[model samples]
Target chain A: MRIVVLAGGIGGARFLRGLRQAAPDADITVIGNTGDDIHLFGLKVCPDLDTVMYTLGGGINEEQGWGRADETFHLKEELAAYGVGPEWFGLGDRDFATHIVRTQMITAGFPLSAVTEALCDRWKPGVRLLPMTDDRVETHVAVELGGERKVVHFQEYWVRLRASVPAEAVVPVGAEQAKPAPGVLEALAEADVILFPPSNPVVSVGTILAVPGIREAIADAGVPVVGLSPIVGDAPVRGMADKVLAAVGVESTATAVAEHYGSGLLDGWLVDTVDTDSVTRVKAAGILCRAVPLMMTDLDATAQMAREALTLAEEVRQA
Target chain B: MRIVVLAGGIGGARFLRGLRQAAPDADITVIGNTGDDIHLFGLKVCPDLDTVMYTLGGGINEEQGWGRADETFHLKEELAAYGVGPEWFGLGDRDFATHIVRTQMITAGFPLSAVTEALCDRWKPGVRLLPMTDDRVETHVAVELGGERKVVHFQEYWVRLRASVPAEAVVPVGAEQAKPAPGVLEALAEADVILFPPSNPVVSVGTILAVPGIREAIADAGVPVVGLSPIVGDAPVRGMADKVLAAVGVESTATAVAEHYGSGLLDGWLVDTVDTDSVTRVKAAGILCRAVPLMMTDLDATAQMAREALTLAEEVRQA
Candidate 1:
């Protein structure tokens, strides 16, 4: 089966690792969110893309779920010695070469899609990783600090501040006019099943959908569009998903997440067994809903979740 | 007293360490050659500038004499795993950060001189280090590979090829139109004495003079432009200096180097004791000449040579 997954960083990388185990023979194409991309120290760093690449390519730090394992901070110290560090985020020295190569290729007249393809040539993550768009579509969050509104990049809000404050608004800066990258719509159209892994709905899938023509292409893909709930028991599985979801006015609940994505794009929605009671409200809202074990504790558990998502997709296709 | 020195990589770095000890109170300015500068894995790497920075900042590896003292290679290994094994040149993980910051700052509307200043802010190298120019003046070498004229970047020729193959021509690509970076001329003009360290005459010092107005400023300084010989008894002090000088039509001799710079720029010249016989020959060319222990074997020895150069400068000033 050809499965297409739209993903964000840590959660997305972990889920894709599981998906690879679940369907080894299934051709997986991941449309990764580049909204969190930051140009740091003169290199283009796509956190989500790198996470997926490293996780699947077997270079990821399993504990940190980001950066390469056995990474060193030589570059960071050198940068610090040069007084060039805003060193909140853990940008390991080993991880920097990837960003540097990507940036170099991009600067040398290649679009990010081409540069990403060139980078993937070495990693060969067994899945085609396509960034949502080649253009710059940064995700920014507005917050009130000292009774004044201030906007910061997604990485600053996520990594540096650790998202401590409440966000007034979340904006994907260039998403309104940003066109989908070349392979995005084709992957969606040719996909047997499109899955939204337990990634941030607001930032991951929402950011992808916000890009012009991508959501419409998925909606008309004529394949089952299944979304697994990132929230269960009124809490996010991991990360600041709940905090960001709150900014977008979505309660950390399965039914609310479903209602937020709404009946427009989702064909099948997977809720955790803990949120089994909320399935009716989701189904009643004109969407096919299934309750399943969604915790990706290990590869087997995540594959099981992947199977559940695919099974729900089959059911929606039949209906 | 104001003093200027032309520099290269490790050997030059070590020599500068001695020069620092010798001229602790002199206002020293380094005319660092960027000919060996290369874009590696997408980062702008200036080997000589870094050598000067690390050495003067007390971060230089005493043993390696190039990178940080206690450096890690985790990033380099990772880059190798990605099959980017340009394994000839040593780019330690700690060192990559400097290049990244420099490249980043340079891309973000800052000239390399300003970036170098910003970088030196933390290193506090004490001596002023200036790049030859802000312009991209890449040095290329024409080599006969299988009887075909192939032009390769200086680093590839020097590091990868190790200058084993014969070089037909060495060209500094943009030097014809490149202006001296800000402060370069003023440093040359205000110098009480300018001493050329035991660096490669062709690639290192030659590239510095290639910048449009620098040679004239040094000639016009009117105090004295004295040089310590990189060549002692026909062989270079270190590296592939002899081969590169031969490529530029200069013989690997103390007299030939002084003759190469010629009567036009230099006022006084110092040769190794081994080349004492050539002092009279060098004097005939209108440059004040002296035979001394020009080889900087240790700090005390180098300090003696530096003092000798100053004494010669005074004698030349009287003449």
Candidate 2:
């Protein structure tokens, strides 16, 4: 089976691990969000991309669900000691090897997508991983701080501020002009099923869809396109999905998120069993909706969610 | 008093430490060689400049005579793990900080000389440290490996090969076209006395003089210019200085080194007491020569050598 997954960070990585378990022989192509990419201490850091790579490649910090396992922060600590900062974003020593290789390749003039492919050669992530766009796309949050409105990088808003203040606007700075990286459209065209992991609809998957032609491609792919809810019972399963969702004036409810993505690009939606009441409302908004136990408590539990999403894809395609 | 010193790695750093103690009130400016500077993992590694800074600043590994004390190789280990190398070069985690700061500042468009000044701000290495040139000048040594004559980076020859083979030629790649860094000529022009520490005659002091106007500046400055012999009893006091000197056709002897710098550029030369027999030979070459106890056993022993150099400067100034 040829499956294309549009992914974000920790949650997406966990879901992919589940998907790999559920479909071991499947040919998976991942389109990773680069909106969270930031340059720290002069090294390029793609949090979402690295999270997926590490998790899928068996190097992930299982407890945190991001970064490398057995990682040390001595590199980051040294950077801090030099007073070179954004000390808030943790980059461990083992994880830093990823960024160093990546930055070295990028600085040598290879496009980021090419660099991603080259790095994947080492990780053997069991999937062809490509960045959403080689061009830079930083998600900025327009927020009110100390009664003054300011725009901060997504990481600053998320990691530094912990999204404490309401984000007045969630902006994907370079999306409109970005072209889908090579193989993206072809993968979409060849995909049998496309899944959006329970990643943040506002900044993770939404920021990617904000890129021109990508959303159009998925909408036109004629494949079963299904998404699992990042929000369950009016709360994000992981991360600060609500704060940025609120930036776009979307409510934290699962139904509202389905309405935000709308029926144009989505074939089906999966909400958690805890939000069973919202299934009918989400279906009423035109997405073929189902309620599944969505808590990724373990490998088997997460694999069950992946299996359920694929089952929904089958039902939507048959209908 | 104003003092200008030409320096290389460990020996120069140790001598500078002694010079600091010997003339506590004197204003000292160190012209550090950059031919040994290299780009490893896309970060600039300035060995000579950093060694001087670290040794004088109390950050140097005492026994190893380079790198940082209490250093970890996690960063280097991680780099090796990625298979991105020159695995031969040892860059410890703490020392990586200096490069990160330097590369960051240089990438932000600061010249190497300015970057050195900023780094010195952190180290507070007593002497004003200046790179020989802001422009890149890598020392490449021509050698025969498996009957193939090829030029390799000096680090490759010294670190990887361990200088085990004969170096056919020693070339400073960028020195011919290089301009002395800002304040280099000014430092030379305003100097009351200049000393060449027991540094590599080929790569260190020689590379510094290779910059366009510096050798002329020293020659025309007309102040007493004294040099301490790097060789003790026909061998370098430390390091593989002898190996590179042979590549340049200079015999590895204290008298030959004095003759290599020659009477035009050197007014006084200090050899170790063991090379006392060669003092007349150096004097016959028209440079005033002294045989002093040159082993830098400790700070006090090194300070005495520094004092001897100053005393020689006074004698030469009178003559």
Candidate 3:
């Protein structure tokens, strides 16, 4: 089977690891959200892409579910000492090598897709990883801080501010102009099943979908388009998904999230057993819905969740 | 007294430490050589300027005479793992921070002089450090590599090749078109005494002089221009100075080095006690010459050498 996954950072990366284990024989192509990419210390940092790459390649900090394992923050500390930073973003020494290489290649006129491919050449992440769009598409959040409204990059909103203030709006700044990276539309078109792992819908998977051609391609792909809820029991499984979901006026519930993606793009939706009650509401909205174990507690449990999603996809295809 | 010093990397940095100790209250301005600067991994690596800053800031590796004292090469190792490198040059984590800051600032349209000043805010290296030129003035060494005469970067020749082959020519690639950095000529004009540290005569001090207006500024400054010879006992005290000195057709000897500068530019010259017999030969060339214990074995010994240079400067002023 050829599976295409739209991934964010930690949660999506962790889920992809499970997906890899569950469908060992399947060819996986990951369309990583680059909206969270930030240039820190003049180097390009693709948080979501690096997470997926490192997680699958065994270089990830398993505990944090992002960044390189055994990493040192000496470079970050030194940068801070020089008063050059967004000291809030923790870019470790080992992790910095990735950005440096990516930035160097990008400056040398290689597109981000080509650079991603070159970087993956080292990780051999098993799956081909393509950035959603090579063009700059930063997710910015409009928030009221100190009684003033301001738009901040997704990273500053998420990593620095910790999403403390209410998000008034969440905008994928350059998505309207960005074309899907070279292989993205083809992968979706060729996919047997398209999965949205339990990543943030508003700024992660949502931003990738916001790219001009990507959402249209997936909707037209003729594959079983399925999604696993990031929300369970009216709360996020991980991360502050509810906060940004509120910005888009989506309720922090599995059924609400499924309805937000809507029946047009989603063929199947998976809610956790904890939110089993929401399955009927989601199915009533014209998309097939199933309640399964959605928490990625460990590799095996996560793999079982992946298997459940695949089974749900088969049910949607048959129906 | 206001003192101006022309400096290179390790040797120049070590000599500055002694000069600082010798004239504790003297106002020192260092015109640092930038020809050895190179871009590696898409970051500007200013070896000589950094050496001076780190050495004076108490961050230098005492044994190696360059880089940070407690440096780690994790970033470098990771870069190598990604197969991105000219692996020979060792840029530690701490050192990489400096280059990253510099590269970022430069890209943001700050000249190297402004970047250097901003960097010094953290190092507090006491002396005002200025690059010889703000314009890119790279030193290229022409050598026979694999039996083909080719020109390579100064860092490639010195660090990578270790100056293994004879240097056929040492050219400061952009010197003719390059103007002295802001305050370089002013520093020379205002100098009470100008001292040339025992840095490489060919690439270090010579390259600085190659900047269009700097040599003229120093000669016209009318202040005592005294130089401590890098060569002692018909050989360089440290580094492979002889290989490059030969490229310029100057013999690697204390007396010969003084003659190479000539009386028009050099007011006084200091050679080691071993080269005492050749003091008259240097004097015959119309520049005042002295023989002193020039070995910088320790701080106190190096300080004595700085004091001797200052004393010689006073004698030249009287003459």
The TM-score values for the models, in the order shown, are 0.94, 0.97, 0.99
lDDT tens per residue, model 1, B1-319: 8888877776666777777777788888888998778888777899889999998888899776677788888777767766776877788887777887887788788988998888888888888989888888888999988889899989889878989898889999989988888889988888888877788888888888888898888888887788778898998877778888889788989999999989888888989889999999999998899898876666788778878878888898888
- Clashing residue pairs in candidate 3 (N, C-alpha, C atoms within 3 angstroms): none
> Across residues A1-319, which tens digit of lDDT does each residue of candidate 3 receive?
9999999999999999899999999999999999999988888999999999999999999998888899998888899999987899999999999999999999989999999999999999999999999999999999999989999999999999999988999999989999999999999999999999999999999999999989999999999999999999999988899999999999999999999999999999999999988989999999999998888989999999999999999999999
Which has the greatest DockQ?
3
lDDT of 2 by residue, B1-319 (tens): 9999999999999999999999999999999999999998999999989999999999899999999888888878767766788788999877887888899999999999999998888789999999999998999999999999999999899889999999999999999999999999999999999999999999899989888999999999989999999999999999998999998899999999999999999999999999999999999999999999999999999999999999999999999
- Model 2 chain B: worst 10 consecutive residues (lDDT sum): B74-83
Sorting all predicted structures by lDDT, with the top scorer first, yields: 3, 2, 1
Segments in model 3 whose C-alpha atoms lie over 4 Å from true places: none
Q: Each prediction's DockQ?
A: 0.71, 0.61, 0.87
lDDT of 2 at B187: 97
Writing each residue's lDDT as its tens digit, candidate 3 over B87-188 gives 999999988999999999999999999999999999999899999989998999999999899999999999899999999999999999999999998989
lDDT of each: 0.86, 0.92, 0.94
Q: TM-score for the first chain of model 1?
A: 0.98
True contacts kept of each: 0.89, 0.53, 0.85
What C-alpha lDDT does candidate 3 achieve relative to the native structure? 0.94
